[model samples]
Target: MICIHLGSATAKNLIEIAGAQTTVCLRIALAGLLAMLIWRPSLRIDPRAVPGIVALGAAIAGMNLCFYAAIEHIPLGMAVTIEFLGPLCVALLTSWRPSNLILAATAGVGVLLLTDSAGTASWTGIGFALLSGLGWAGYIVFGKAVARHTATNDALALALGLGTLVTVPVLLTRAEDLPLDPWFLIGAVAVAVLTSLVPHAIELNALRRMEVSTFGVMMSMGPAVAALAGLLLLGETLRPVQWLGIAAVVGASAGATLLADRHTPAAPETPGEHQPIRPTPSEAVPVP
Candidate 1:
């Protein structure tokens, strides 16, 4: 995740040189290419897995585009916090426990405060951030299904390949302005490796083992990560409340991740009473 946002900060730096659409098309395309080189998949996808793969690919494309558009207008951390709504929704909807609710609310309060800190940002940035959040939610929901069939690296590789395909139109539209300068190209390669390749592959591996809610809580840390990235890399300073928000989100993530795993209670059963078997944490969120 740190790699992901660091790549994003790198892209943000290049936006002025390459424009948002062009930078994003390049990032996705290059990342997909690297993933393909590593995985070298046969593209022999199961019919059942097609929908999930397609959805994940589309979600990646939309999320990347919208998030780039958002950061073009607002700071990276602010945009990421707004985008957290997507996974937070996934966490609550997939499984509901009182502990989950409290932790999610803590994260929610953090988002509110962070949002408040960005008092003067335009609605356009916020709207794009919201759209990005929706795309992220779709990514998480469909990603699990894809992982089940394709495994980790292949799943992310194939999805990024599809996302790269989606960028063809944009790339063509911006072809005239695209840069070939060696320095910029170097940064782009780093961006591809950090944001597009490493973080997503990590996410796929993590999602395969953990419950969606656990994953979501873990992902709730993204805002903090992005915030720090923005501060350190881009010099985008945060207000005191924004720092407070990060602390809240971190606390919620720590508590929920531990609590969700540790608290599987055994229901008492009488000799004749049949106890319904519960789904393991990873199985709680079904693809259907």
Candidate 2:
């Protein structure tokens, strides 16, 4: 929400400002610092896991970059709704429960309503949003693989490191557009806090106390949250139809999660480990 408002308030071109190249660099740098300060991943090298970690970082970077780009061209609410397809896809892909099909269909209809409005809709932007969703799905799959081989703290740090390395080239190419003004720096920090650090910290803490299905159900409210943020921060009002669509998507996501929780077996507890149960088939793990 902050990013959308800031980007719009500025005279910059949204595509150039929020494209795959720029956001990747910024997120990599910001998240890398946060993860390193918080986790301090061991310097030890795991030769076998390096490739997977690199791929995971790349996917994470791609997801952030693409989603920011999509939002550059669409309302934050609409962008979030479309981008949410990634996790929804992950949920449906892993589950075979017949009941989830209805939830999936409902989400699909909501997305259609979100993107089909004549005057406000941009097909190109919607295309970018879909692409962002695919990237997010990729991020979750690869991130889970990385998490399996290392601690979340270490894995996230490494992923950010790799992402930063991957994004350096693009950052250099766009150096001229980089903001150096003190106020812009302040705004960027605010964006980092609102979109990245705070959410990551809160969610990570929450995940320690919750199940994957429960977490999924909770996170399904993100679009609605974003909508609320948009209303408060940007004075963006949703039409009745759009509000209905938002409700449908939120309801379906929550319903699917609840159903998954009821039917899925509880995760096994490890002996001597006091850590909370981690959700399987992780969702977007939002960076922005």
Separately for all candidates shown, the number of backbone clashes (residues 3 or more apart, or on different chains) is 0, 1
lDDT tens per residue, model 1, 1-288: 777888889999889898888888899998888778766655776667788988998999899989999999999999999999999998888866778878888898888877876669978999999999999999998987776666566667788898878886778988887887999998888887777776787687667667777778778888999999999989999989889999999999999778856874433332212322222221245311
Looking at candidate 1, the ten consecutive residues that score lowest on lDDT are 272-281
TM-score of 1: 0.89
Candidate 1 stretches greater than 4 Å from native: 260-288
TM-score of each: 0.89, 0.76
Quantify all predictions' global Cα lDDT against the true fold.
0.81, 0.59
Deviation of model 1 at 186, angstroms: 1.1
Give the winner by lDDT.
Answer: 1
